[model samples]
Target: MIRARVGARDAMRILTEVARANGQIFEALGVSKSSVSRKAASDQFLSRSESERILGLAKLIGQVQSMTNDAEADAPAWLATWMAEPVPALGGERPINLIGTMEGQTVVSNMLGHVLRGGFA
Candidate 1:
């Protein structure tokens, strides 16, 4: 079963893919094991900012896949461009954290969804 909700689940799935492509997102995002565990618990609610962080990481991860598909694609260079682009902060209103945990099983479910659906777009 999916650990996160629809959007969050997809975000996490892409995040994992990015990790496979470039490096660990936890390390890149300065996310500690504890934070990951907390997020994976499915019982803890993540703040909107935290969720945005995950989304941002997921988008970057998606870009990695896109770059990999093109031989001439420069992932790092494109990553710089992505970072330079303006991104509006989403889920910033109120406390948008959910009271659910994202576990390994959930991640797997999300991954399966991506695999079945041709990856995140």
Candidate 2:
């Protein structure tokens, strides 16, 4: 598992980067940004299951990227691992609380670095 700090903006940026990198995968897989947006707005996206899936995909991509040097090499693995960890304290709260991400703009920078470079690693 990746061990580093990943904040809200970073997480969002990662998702966006993933979308951009594998937009075709999301499209072919039927995970549209619009759908994700709608779900997010309605507090429907990133359910525990969905969060798990997204994190799993993110980790896979990170792992693949880690194998190379496309960029985002310094991204925190804890961010992805956070998605897999359960939060009993958030009972009935947002399925995926990214408040932490919002607090860490550096993560955004990291994500931008990757997005700019294109793909994970």
Give me the candidate number with maximum TM-score: 2
Error of 2 at 74 (Å): 11
Q: Report the error of model 1 at residue 71, Å.
A: 14
Stretches of candidate 2 off by over 4 Å are: 1-12, 28-30, 42-45, 69-121
* Per-candidate RMSD, Å: 11.9, 14.1
Clashes of each: 8, 6
Give TM per candidate: 0.36, 0.37
How far does residue 58 in candidate 2 sit from its true spot (Å)? 0.9
Which digits, one per residue and each the tens of the lDDT, describe model 2 over residues 1-121?
A: 1233233333355567544433333332234456566665654434343344445445545654564555745333433333334444334232133322322223333443454456442
Off by over 4 Å in 1: 1-12, 62-121
Model 1 Cα lDDT, one tens digit per residue, 1-121: 1234324344455555445444444454444546555565665544554565665544444545563576666554444333333333312211112102243223333433454356631
Identify the leading candidate in terms of lDDT: 1
User: Which residue pairs does candidate 2 place in steric collision?
Assistant: 2-77, 7-101, 8-101, 8-102, 9-101, 65-121
Report how far residue 10 has shifted in candidate 2, in Å.
Answer: 7.1
